[model samples]
Target: MQDIAVGGSTVSRTDILGQVEAVGVGSFWATDEEGRLVYLSAKALDALGGGGESLIGRPLVEIFSEVQQANGEEAQRTLGFQLRSHSRFDNMIVRVDVAGDDETGQRQTRWWRVSGKPYKDGNDRFCGYRGSSIDITAEYGRQLEAAQHSQFDPLTGLANRRRMGSRLSAMLTACKGAGRSCALVMLDLDRFKQVNDTLGHPAGDELLKQVADRLKTVIKDRGEIGRLGGDEFQIILPDIDDRGDLTGLAGRIIQMISQPYSINGKRAIVGTSVGVAIAPYDGVESDELNAAADLALYAAKGSGRGLCRFYTADLRESAELDSRIEENLRDALVKGEMRMNYQPLVSPHDHTVHAFEALMRWEPEDGRPVSPAKFIPIAEQTDLIVQLGGWALRQACEDAVQWPTQLRVAVNVSAKQFMNADFPKVVAAALAGSGLEPNRLDLEITESVFVGDVEAVDKTFAALKRLGVRLVMDDFGTGYSSLGYLNRAPFDKIKIDQSFVHGCTEGGTTNPAIISAIVALAKALGMETVAEGVEAMDELALVTERGADLIQGYIYSRPLTHDAIMERSGTENFVFPPSGPPRYRAGRMNFFRKIGVIHEDHYYKAMLRNLSRTGAWIEGLAGVPEGTDLILDLGGGQLAVSKVVRAAEAAQGLKFETALIGDGNDGLMTRHRVSPYALATAGMPLAALPAGSYPLAEQMSASRSPRKFFEVEV
Candidate 1:
C-alpha cells in the first residue's frame, strides 16, 4: 500500500510485477492462461545470462529443450499433487542443467533449485505460474557431505561404526531369513600406546589409517569395514555361506594389521588381534554377536596379542581399570594447604638487597611436595591459581611496604592470573590496604599472558597503570611475544629467565651474544634489564660488565625478614644520618634572621627562599635548570646542590645531596628557583601564579607552555 510517482501519473495493480522488478526481485509475465513468457524483471534477465531476453514471448516449453520438456511435465505433475494436497515443501530438492565451462573448452551442466506456483489475475482467475528459482548448489554439496560422513569414517574415510553396524544388522537379518551365513570380526591393535608414546600420537593415528587402507585392499568388495575407536576396528562379511568365509576374512584382517608402517621417517612394526563371531550359529541377537566378538578379542589378546580366536564364555574379567586421574585432582585444591616462599634479589654492586620475589610452593601433608611444574599447571587449569595469585600479591605487598625504602618487591603472575577480570582491582586494593607506594610493587608476568585475548590484557594493563605499579616482562626471549608487543606494552623492566642466565656464565661465547642482544634491545626500548640466577662472582661480573641493571640469585643472602633488611641496610647511623644545610644564627647580631647565598650578585635567601626536601618552592634570586648540578656559596660556606626536579605544569625543587657545614655555627644551604618571586610580581596569589613568569626561562617555558599559549589581560 505504498505510493510511487510514475512518469506522468500513478498506476495501481492488485499484484504489481513491474514494481517487484523495479525493486530487483526477478519478475516476469506469461501470456493468457497457458503460461507463455511476456515480460521479465531485469534480475530474471541477468540470472538467465546472455540472450535470455530473446524468448520473452516464447511458450514455457520453448525455454527448455526436448529432454528437459519431458522432465518439466513430470515436475509439474508432482507440483500439482503437492498443491492439491495443500502440502508445502519448504526446501524440496530439484536440479537443472545450466551451461558452464570446464577446464577444457566445453560446456557442462550446472545445478540449481527450480520453484513454481500458480499466478492469478485481478478477477481471481488463474493466469500462469510465478515463483523464484534459487541457486541451491551449496546445499546439495552439504547434503553430499552428510551422506558421505554418514557412511565413511572421519579419520580414514573408511566405513564408520554406525554404517558398519547397519550393514552387519542387515546382513545378519538376511542370512537368518534365507538360511545363509555371515560373520562379524573385531580388531584391537597391540602395543599401539607404545607407538603413541614413542613416536607421537600423530604417527600412531597415521598407522591406524594405513591399517584401514590395507584391510580394504585385502578384503576387496567382500565385506564392510569400520574404525570403532582408537586402535579398534570392525569388519562385517555378508553372504559368506560357510565357516571358511569367516576364517578367511579373519586371516586377512590379521595379515593387514601385522604389516609394518613407516611414519615420520621411523619404521614401526605394530600388530593387532582379530576376533570373529558367526551369525545364526554364535548368537541370534546383534548384542550377543558383539559380545561373542569381544570374547574372541579377549581370547586373541590372551593368546599373545597379535592373533585371532573364537569367542568363549570366560573372557569377561578384564574390562580396564577406569584410569581417569582427573577426579582426584578436583578435590585437592579446596583443602587450603598451599604454601609459597620468597627469593631474594640482590643488587650486584655492594650486595645491597633490592627485592624479594614471591615463588609458589605446595606440599600436601599426606603427599610429598608437589613440583611447581606439576601442580602449577593443574592450578592454572582450575581457579586455584587465581585465588593463589591474589594471596601472593597481598602478602608480597604487605611485606614490601614494611621493608626499607631502597628495596622494592616483585611477584610472579601466571597467565591465568593475569587474565582474571578482577586482577587490576585486586592489585590496587592490595597495594592500598598494605599502605605501600605503587612504585615499590612490581608484577612479573610471563610472555604467555600476552598470547590470549590481547584486548583484555590491554585493559588489564591500563588498570594496573592507574595503581602506579611497575610491570616486568618475566622470562623474555622464551615465548612467542613479538618485539612489537614489547614496544607497545606497559612494561617497566624485562627479566631474563634463569635458563638463559644459566647459559650466559658458561664459557661459550654464544650465550654472551644472545644476552648482549637482549640487553641492547631492552636499552633501545628504554627498559631496565635484570639477569636472574647469577650464582657466582664471575657470573655477576660478566652480567654487570654487560650493563645488566639488576642481578638476583644465591650469590647474596636469600629472602630476608624486616629485621634482616634493617641489618643489611646497616646500623642506625647508616639508616638515619644527619643532614647539614645553611643555619641562620643571629647571635644577637645577624640581620633579617635569614641566611643568604650569592649566585652572580643576585643574593638568594638561603633558608626561607630555598627548596625543601618535601617539594615546596620559596622565593629566591637564583634560577637553575630542572636537574642542574650547582654549588651554593652562603656567607657561611659552599655546599654542593642540584636544581629543582621538573613536573607537569608545576615545577618541584631539588633533592639535597651535600649540604655542608660552613664557618662557625653556620650551615650552607642550596639555592632555590625564582618562580615564587615571579608570582609576587603578579597580583595573583603566589601559589596561583603560573610557573612561566619565573626568570628560570627554560623551566618556565617547558612547564607552562599551555599557560603561555593564550594572551592574558592585566
Candidate 2:
C-alpha cells in the first residue's frame, strides 16, 4: 500500500513493515530455492526462540509442521512435502513443536497460519519463497482442547462412551477385513450403590476414579477402557482371540478393581464381574459383540458376583432362566416354597454339635432347584434379599427355639439386610417372637457388610452385640477381610472360607498355612474358628491339627431337615465320626456326558464320566494304552491335550496337559479354544463345535487312516 504522511514526515512502506515486525502481529520470511531460510523478520526470530544468525541457513520446513486435523485421518500433504514440490500454497495452518522453541517459555507449541509462493532469481530459475505468518496459538489451542473434552470422561480422563463405541466399531471393521479378532469386555461394580448410599455421592465419584486408575494399570497399553455411565464399563482389547490371554486380562481387571479403596477417609469394598466376547467367533460386528459381552456379564453375575465369564451360546438360555428365577423368587415366601435346613457346626475335639447354621433352601413352584449361587446375586441386586433374609432369620429362630437349650443357631445376614438401620430390631423381634434367647442366635456376616460408612457399620455391629447375639464373620480369610477389620468388629467366631479348606491337605498348597494362620488369629482374639467344607478325613485331620475349634461340612453330615434332627436328637447321636473319602480328591464334578477323544488323526466317540480342572474320566473307548497323548474335544471349541493316566478295560483316566480355568459357573473349561480363524484356515465352515458332537474340522473328517481304538457305546 502507499506510505502514510505524518505531521512533519512520511512513513515509508519498509517502515510500516518494520512496525508490523515490532508489534508481533505477523512476521515476514523468505526461503532460498533449497527451502533454506534466507531472511526472517525479528518477530519470526523471537518465535523461533533462536538467534537470527543461527537460524539463517536452516531449512524452513524443519521449523514447522502442518497442524493435525480434528479427525484421526492423516494429512494428504505435509508442509515439508509441499515446500519440496515448489508449489504455491495459501492459508495453511502449521505448528512448531520443537523443544525450547518458545521465546517466553510460556508456550511449548506455537501455531501459525501462512501463505507463500515460489519466486524466481536473476537467472529465471526458482530461487526462493516469501511468506507472512500470523500467530493462531490462542484460537487453535482452544479448538484442540475442546475436541479433547468431547472424547474423554472428565472425571477419569478415560474415553467416553461415544468415543469408545466409535473406536470399537472401527477396530471391528478393520479386524474383520484383516481376518483378525478383537475382544470386548464388559463389567460393572458390584455393591457400589451401598457405598454411595451410605457415604454420599462424592465418595462414589472418588471410588470410580480409583477403579478407573486400577483398570488403567491392569489393562496398560493393551486396550481402551471407557466408563459407560454409573458403575458400568466397557473395554476394547484389540487383536486378542485366545481365551487364555483374555482370561488373564479379565482376571487381573477383577482382582485390581476389587481391592479396597479409601474414599473420603472411609473404607469401601466393591467387586466386579467381567464378561468377554471375541469378534468373528462371538460376533463380527460391534453391536453383536457388545450384546454377546453383555450376555456373558449377565451370566457372570447370575453365577455370582466377583467372577469372569466368556460368552457362550447357552447364556441366552440362562438369561431366560434368570428372568424366570427372579419372578418365582418374588413369590417364594408367600408360596411357602422356602425352607431351612440346618447344617451342624460340630466341635472337632468332641465330635458334638456346638450349633447348627440355618441355611435357606427354595424349591420353586416349577420344581426346578436353583442353587444359591445362581439366585442370591439376583436377590441382592433387587430388594428380595432383605425380605428373604428377614423371613429366614424369623424361621431359623423359630426352628432353633425347639432344639435343646444349650444349642444355638446361626443365620446368614446379607449385606443389604445388615446395612439396614432396623436390622438389630428385626433380630430382637425374631428372638422375642420365637421365645428364643438372644444369645441363642448367631448373626452371620461377610466382609462385604463393611462397605459403607465406617461409623454406621460400627454402630450396627455394636447394636447387634448389645442384643447379645453372636457375630460370626462368614467366609473369613477369603482375601475380602483383613485382620485389621477383626480388631474393628466384635466377632465371636470366624469360619475359614471353603476355598482354603478344599485343598488344605494337598502338598505345595498354601491353604494349610492360611488355615493355621486363621485359626491362630481367631484363637489369639478369643474367637472360635470353624473350618468350612471339610469333605474328607484328610481335610478334617489337617484342620483339627491346625487348632480349628469346629468343623462344619459333609465330612460329618449333609444339611438335615428339622425332622431328621428331631429323630436323631432323641437318641443323642450327635457324636459322629468323620465319614468321607480317605484322601482329598481334586473335587471333580460327576459330569456324565458324551464327548469326543482325538488321538492323532482318529476321532473316537467317548463318554465323559467325570470332569475336573486337572483331569477327566472317559469311557466308551477300548484298547487305549496308558501315556497315550490324546486331545479331548469337550465341545464349545474346547480341545484339551491330555495323556491317558489310567487304562482299564474301556475306562481311562486322562490327565490334562494344561489345566482348565473356571467357566465362572463352578465348572472347568479350557483356557484356549479353537478359533474361527483356525477353522477357516483348516478349510472348515464357520459352525459351532459343541459337546456331544465331533466335527473334525472338515479336513480331517475324510481321513482314510485306520482307527487306533474301538469306539463302543457306553
Candidate 3:
C-alpha cells in the first residue's frame, strides 16, 4: 500500500486513507457503478453513532434502511434514475426521521435533509457517494411557521391581509372568467380610538383579537375573513347572487362585532361600520373595487357607525372632486398661481404690528379666491401639500427680507408636508433661495403630524431647529390631542384655532376665561399662544387681557400683497392732513401760533385714542405711535397743527377741547374767518355780549358776512 508522490505528497495509501477519515464532516465510499457505499470514514461512523466499522463493505441500502424506512432500494432506484437523467447533482437534499434518546423525551422523530454528491476514483470511474447529514428540522419548522404567518393573522390565527390579497386576486380572475359578481366588504371598528385612548393599548389589543375571533366565527364557511390591520378587517364574498346576500352578511358581521368582548375578563362593547363594493357593479377592476369599498367605508363612517354603505356613483363623484382638487393644486404650483398672502399679526395689547402670518391662497384666473379650507384638504389628499408648503415657506422668507429684521414670518405646514421625506431639504432650499434668516421663519404644523412616526418627526424637527427656525403646533386641541407630543416634540409656539378663538370671542367674558386657560396651558409648556381669527376690537382686547402673545385676523387687515405691505410699512411715516368740511375763518393763522382745535366730532374714535402732549400715541392704532403735522378745522377756522394732542379718552376734559397756542384776533383778521364773540383785555373779555362771567351771544347782535378763508389767504 506504498504510494508514489501525488501533488507533492509522498505517502502510503493507508496514510491517505487515514487523512480522508480525519476530515471533520464525513467521507464515505461505494463500489458499484450505481455508487453504493463500500466504506465509511471514521467521522462518518461517529456521525451515525458507532456504525462505521460495521457498515464497511455494506450496500448503501442496508445502511440507510436502519436510519429511515423511506431510504430502501426503491429510493436508490429513484436516485439512480435522477443521476442518469440529470448531470452531476449539487446540494441534492433528502430528509429522514430518526428517534431521539429516551432521556430527551422524544415522542415523534424529527426529520433532516441529507445532501450528497457522487465521488470518483483516480481512474475517473464512479466510486461512492460522500456527504453530510444536516439536522434541518428546526429550519424547516421556521420556514413552515413563516409561511403560515404570511397567510394568517398572528393574533387570532385567522387569515391576514396578505392572504386576503392573494385570495382576492384569484377571485377576481375567477369572476372575470365566469362573468360573475363578487363583493368585497371592508370593516372598521368604530370608536376604536376612544377605547385605545381612554383604556390601555393592551386592552385595545385584546379587544381587536376578540373582534377578529368573532369575525372568523361569523364568516365561517361563507367566505374568507382576514384582519386587514389595526382595527380593520376584510371579507371576500365570491359568487354573490344578489344585493341582499351582501347586506345579510354585513348585518351578521355588525351584529357579531356589536356584542360585548371580554378583554382580560372585562366586558367591553364595540361596533363596526362595514363598507361594501361589488365587482362588475361598483367597479370592474379589483383595485377600483377596493378603492370603492374604501370610499363606501368612509361614507359608512361618515353616516355614523354601526351601519354599512354601498358604493354609488355619487361617492365616486365626491371622490373625483377630491381628485380634481388635488390635481389642480399640484398644477397651481407649477403655474405660479399659488401665492402667500400676508395677514398682519398684531400685538393685541397695543395693536402694533408684530409680524405677518403667511396664508396660502390660490387665485385662479376666472374664479374668486379659493379658500384654504377648500384647497388645503386637497393638498393633503394628493400630497401636493409638501410642495405648496415649501413654496409658501420660500415666499414668506423672501417677503420677510423686505420687512423689519425683527419681524418674523409664519408659514403653516400640513401634516402631509411635515411628514415628507424631504421636508428638511425643502426648508433648506426655501431659506437658501430667499436669503432670509432662518430665525425669522416660523413653521406651523397641526398636532396630527406628531401622532405617528414621532421619532422621524422629532429628528426632522430637531434638524429644522438647528437652522434657527421656530416650529409651532397649529390648531392645538383640535384633533388627536396629545399632551405627550409637547413632552416629546419641541414646540416653540401654539396656535389656538379660529374655532376656539371665535367661540371665546362670542362668549365675551367667558371668552377671556377660555383664552386665559389656553394661555396658561401654553405658558406651562413653555410655549407662546397666537390667537387666530381675532376679528373684532373686543376680541382683541379680550385676548390681550388674557395674555395672548399674538393675534391675527381681518380686524386689523386682510392678506395683503408684498408691494402693499412694503408700501404700508415704508411710506407710513409721512403724515396726512384730515379730510373733512373746511370751516370759514377770518384769520391769516401764523403756522407756529396756530393750535389746531380739533372738535370731538371732527376726529374719528380711532384718532381720539390715548396719548400725552409729548408725542405720545394712541395705544390701539395699527401704525406708528407718534403723530405728525396735519390741518384741522375747529368749526371757527382751519389751522395747521405741528402736532396733535391726540389725547386719551380720559384726557378729553369737559367738551373734549384742545388748547390753542395764540390769540384769535389778529389770527382771524389775516383771513376771512370769524368767531361769534370778540376777545378783550383785563381778563379775556368778551365784546358785544351780555354781562356775565361767561361769554354769551346778544339778541339781534350786529353781524358781518365773512369771505371764504382759503381765497382770502391766497
lDDT to native, each model:
0.59, 0.83, 0.61
Ranking by lDDT: 2, 3, 1
Name the candidate that leads on TM-score: 2
Stronger candidate by lDDT (1 vs 2): 2
lDDT of 2 by residue, 1-714 (tens): 598898999989878898977877788888887889888777777766753456678888776687666543235665776788888888888876544634664545678888898898688899889888888889888877876677778888888888888899989889868878889999998888888887889999999999999999998899999998899999999988777778778778877876778876677888888999888778878889999999999888766567789998888998898888898899998998998999999988889998999988888777877787777888987889999999999999888888888789999998889989999999999999999999889988987787656678899999989899999999886545468689999999999989999978888999889998988889889999988999989898999999999899999989989888788778878776779998888878997788878766566778999998999999999999999998888876688989999999999999999998777777778877775446445543223233323344545444456767998878
Which regions in candidate 1 have their CA more than 4 angstroms from the true location? Answer: 1-336, 363-368, 505-509, 536-538, 557-714
What lDDT, from 0 to 1, does candidate 1 have? Answer: 0.59
lDDT of 3: 0.61
lDDT of 1 by residue, 70-111 (tens): 111123335435444433333334443334333453433323
RMSD in Å for model 1: 34.6
The true-structure Cα RMSD of candidate 3 reads 34.4
List model 3 lDDT by residue over 265-336, tens digit each.
Answer: 544555678888777656667788889899888666544355677766567676666666666667787777
Q: Tell me each candidate's TM-score.
A: 0.38, 0.87, 0.43
Give per-model CA RMSD: 34.6, 4.7, 34.4
lDDT of the structure predicted as candidate 2: 0.83
Model 3 lowest lDDT segment of ten: 663-672
